[model samples]
Target: MKEGSRLLDEMNDRSREVFRRVVEAYIESGEPVGSRTLTRTLSEKVSAATIRNVMQDLEFLGLLDSPHVSAGRIPTQLGLRMFVDGLLEVRDLDHHDREKLDATLGAGAGDVGGLLDRVGAALSGVTHGASLVLTPKHEAPMKHIEFVSLGHDRALVVLVFADGHVENRLFAPPPGQTPSSMREAANFLNAMIEGKTLSELRRDMAREIAARRQELNSLAAEMIETGMAMWEGEADNSARLIVRGRANLLGGEAEAEELDRIRTLFDDLERKRDIAEFLQLAETGEGVRIFIGSENKLFSLSGSSLVVSPYMNADRKIIGAVGVIGPTRLNYGRIVPIVDYTAQLVGKLIAERSER
Candidate 1:
């Protein structure tokens, strides 16, 4: 048996039953589970004293905790992790949810970015929590490249991908570059770099440029060099992070004291790097990745949990992720399958598009 299963096996029947009830109650109310409530909630004939003793014993085992000196007990992050891994029953999406997700994702057939935005919105609406979608930075080869003059040494670099996606970025051009020079640069790049990925172009650019240097004037050559330099070592931001339903983090049955934690989470969200790093870790694994409260350093201060699942491409390689972020009490059994299905749907859509 695995470690989680072994741990479950070690618990006595009463301990296991009481622990499960406490977790279930906590998940439902987002509050600590008191002995009086457990007496009424549990099917067993155990007295309140007996249930309280069980709660303490479970606490000693690091499964439950008390939020206050005289308050009820709540399941710790460790307890929740074990409960999800060992005891939870994940169910399939119902007919209604299936249709909803299908309609939402199908709306964007060939537009990958727009599809991912819908994925994020769908997840957030379903789970009543913030949703995140991390899409692959490079999905298709370039169909065309152009540099348009925007003045003040700033130029607009427009990239048209074979997938029919157009992305434009404002970049600083080399000094002394003109509209004519930029057009020359665009013509030079489009002639050689079309139909190739950024990675492929990076590999052959130096050799290609060196061989053709004599044919290109000094201004055009400098513009080309500067444009290439702008993209180096910084394009990884292409792994886009789309977040929705942030307001869902507030309201509901949340306690007054919990507001501080929510505030902290709001501040944390401002740091995209932190959210990006968390999702990157999810990409390393298959299926759904669950980080319960303190298990993830990013949300520890806010006592939040994240359910992330990586989406793949036609080749069965992981390409991106879609996930939900909410309070620790968010429904895992329901959200897990929803996230998994969404990831699979995204991968399927991408695969179908690639085949064409």
Candidate 2:
């Protein structure tokens, strides 16, 4: 499809009015809009014949589509993109919306993950669609690491991230490793890599081990490698895509024919790794980003829409993102501002917690 930038300014005033009305009607009722319906819904009285001609012109220009031979027209994904980028006017959140967001997110949660989960759940409840929150990873440097024997060659690596996010991983000791060796390993790592990001620590450890393999104690090096590997793996997995409210899509007012499409979307959501990487694109921009159906690689096959906005830290750095996913006929004007506001609230909450 042609980018909205090329086609948005090419439409005549009459075509633009008819297209806008058709899209608005479709978004409200989730149904195709005929010329007669457009005539009744539009503020200005336009003849049905004129609307039909305008719609035909829009269809020809790839802005609209008729799903059935006798059915009314609906805005194509391209059309929705154009409307969102060029024609859409975002409304301010109502009092109820503001209050709901404040009540849900304004309170200080104990940790970053809890706050992020609440934000995802609230967005899902508000938009009635699947919500996703890509959480910030390793928000603070490591304060401590410990290991306890679970017996029978198993041990637990306990992590205390500086921000108070604690995690535990099960590990197997390399032949005859004891609790003393484990403590020694933890102490050595703490002294060597304290105040460094997990990523940085991992890189430094790899270089140190390579350069001084013989100088380093064999048991200490082995323990550090095992512990660091677990930490790295957990960090990568924990700060991944958090998807909620998948059932919301199926339980909505969609028709039976749309079941296959929803199932396809469910399968797509199951690809969490891909979704997490795809969401990173949102962090490149400053404000809300809307990906209409087919416009995004992840949602293209599912024929869905995504509205995402990045959340920032106190340093004004974009750390993660929150968004809603649903069918293309979503209420753009309403959902756009809601997602935008939720993102801002999440950023504010994270920043406040960081200061604490």
Candidate 3:
């Protein structure tokens, strides 16, 4: 009869305890929990008949449901939401989990790109769900540079950053350009970018090239200038996304309808538009956030849940997010702390990188 949050407040203490026990048991086994089962689990000395009466009252309140007349009851989506928003007891992240995250993410701290992949892997491992890691734009010192010819006067500039990020930029070659000249230009520009970022090179590029004009022919110089000019101006603000452990979403105990929902969820994951929307969810508001089933607009039909926390930089600006994706029936009490701790570690990593 009462609304979600208020229902907990209005519920009699015995009724509330019985409802909580039912939701916990159902979440543990994904089965309808009988009042007899609650009688065993509840610390209070309650009789099975009394618990059954409470369950009936709960079902009447729209917080619980029974699949059959004599079978046990399960919490509805609204019921689960109410529990998560109120009754769930989330623990602090344990020391072992903190160390594991450090070891996993810090495997190769210098390789920021590889670290992003590991972040996804660690999140999936910890939360038992598909992980979506949204990485910020790649802007780091140059590690290596190469120019590959794509024919038809088109060439590809493959850039390897010091922080393990690799990017490809396309450019058209100038007239009279040959393989030898392109190689010569690559060697010359590579030397100029050893400790400099793309932005720095763009700023002092003309002067640097003018000084080395005698080393390269007119055509090679023109080619190098054209290639470098393409990378000038602001770096692309587009976030690079990493998706891992999608297979983990499969092979769970599910009915035909639930199986269909999982398939629909996979289909949504493969869609660019849906993925973009999912990423936007991580950027919404702050702290650790949870979206259960239909509350998540992108995968509403799939009946999926997302537990995410945004990681920020030294400036407290949210740089990215680390989170998990799974079915609606997940262990929120356990996963919340893991996600929150991981996000904090990621934020610290971002801060460390900025200082370097």
Candidate 4:
């Protein structure tokens, strides 16, 4: 297929008008749009035959396709891309949309996890499509570390971040360890491991303990290693996947085989690891990324569409992503701006949370 940018440039005034009308009609009705409908609705002074000829040219350009020989042409993936990139005029969030978004964002504070869950649910409700929110990767520098004795051989290691985020990990103390040893180990780590990444602290602590065998008691060194191991495990499991509105996919008209494929897609999404990988790709991208049919291997069977945008922190570093997934017939002109706006809103919320 030709690049959407080149195809958009090649379209003349009359052809562009016909193409826009057909794309708009198809998006609204989710059906093939005939030239007659364009003639009736468009304000342009053009006959049905003229519109038909232009649509034929657009079909040759791979922007339009006819599902049936007798039916009119509908916008293809390329057509949607061209319209979204060149023709679609994104409007400001309307009063209703702004009010709904504000209400959703205002419902919670302090708990980032709860705020993200509500954001995903609100997005799904507004878009009528599946919504996804990938949790921010923890990159805060360590401020302090402490190991508190909980019970028999099990201790709770509290990690305080420079951003005021505190996470606790439960760990079993190494063999032949006591609460006094654990306390000593905690003091040693708090003195040496402050303002370092978990990985950095782990590597440095390992080297120090290995080099100085006789400098400290064996039990104290073992307790320190145990606490470091717990922090590493928690960091590995920190990224979360939030998905909502799987039921909305079933409401559309699709063949049984297609429905089965969609079910499989949902199953794949349920695996948090895979979803995290997918969202990670978008998180590193420059801006909103659109994946059309057959563009990604995961959704090839379902021929689904994904519109994603990364949400950033106060420093403009991408911390997460928010997006919608639906069938190829999704309204890109409408949904693209919605996703973009929502991403910005998510970024703002994250920045505020980080400041706190």
RMSD of each: 5.3, 5.2, 8.9, 7.0
Off by over 4 Å in 4: 140-237, 284-287
lDDT of 1 by residue, 1-356 (tens): 66566767899888888999989888888788899998887877889999999899888888899989869999987788889988887888777777888988888455677888899898888777899888787747878889988886688888888888788876778889988888998888888777788667766777878998999989998998877766542334346678889889877766776778977876876654375565566767799989987778877888888898988888888777888988888888888989899999999988888788
Report the error of model 4 at residue 121, Å.
0.6
Off by more than 4 A, model 3 = 138-237
Q: lDDT tens string, model 2, 65-157?
A: 999986999998888988888889898887787788788876665678788888888888888888988888764687887888889589887
| Leading candidate by TM-score | 2
Output the TM-score of candidate 1. 0.76
Clashing pairs in 3: none
lDDT of 3 by residue, 99-161 (tens): 878889888766556777889999888776888787765557877878887885788888888
| Best-fitting candidate, scored by lDDT | 1
As for model 3, its CA RMSD to the true structure in angstroms is: 8.9
What are the models' TM-scores? 0.76, 0.78, 0.71, 0.72
Computed on alpha carbons, the lDDT of every model, listed in order, comes to 0.81, 0.80, 0.79, 0.78
Q: In candidate 1, residue 46 scores what lDDT?
A: 89
The true-versus-predicted C-alpha distance at residue 133 of model 1, in Å, is 1.0
Ranking by TM-score, best first? 2, 1, 4, 3
Write one digit per residue (lDDT tens) for candidate 4, span 242-275: 8899889877687797788788777766643255
**For model 2, the run of ten residues with the poorest summed lDDT:** 229-238
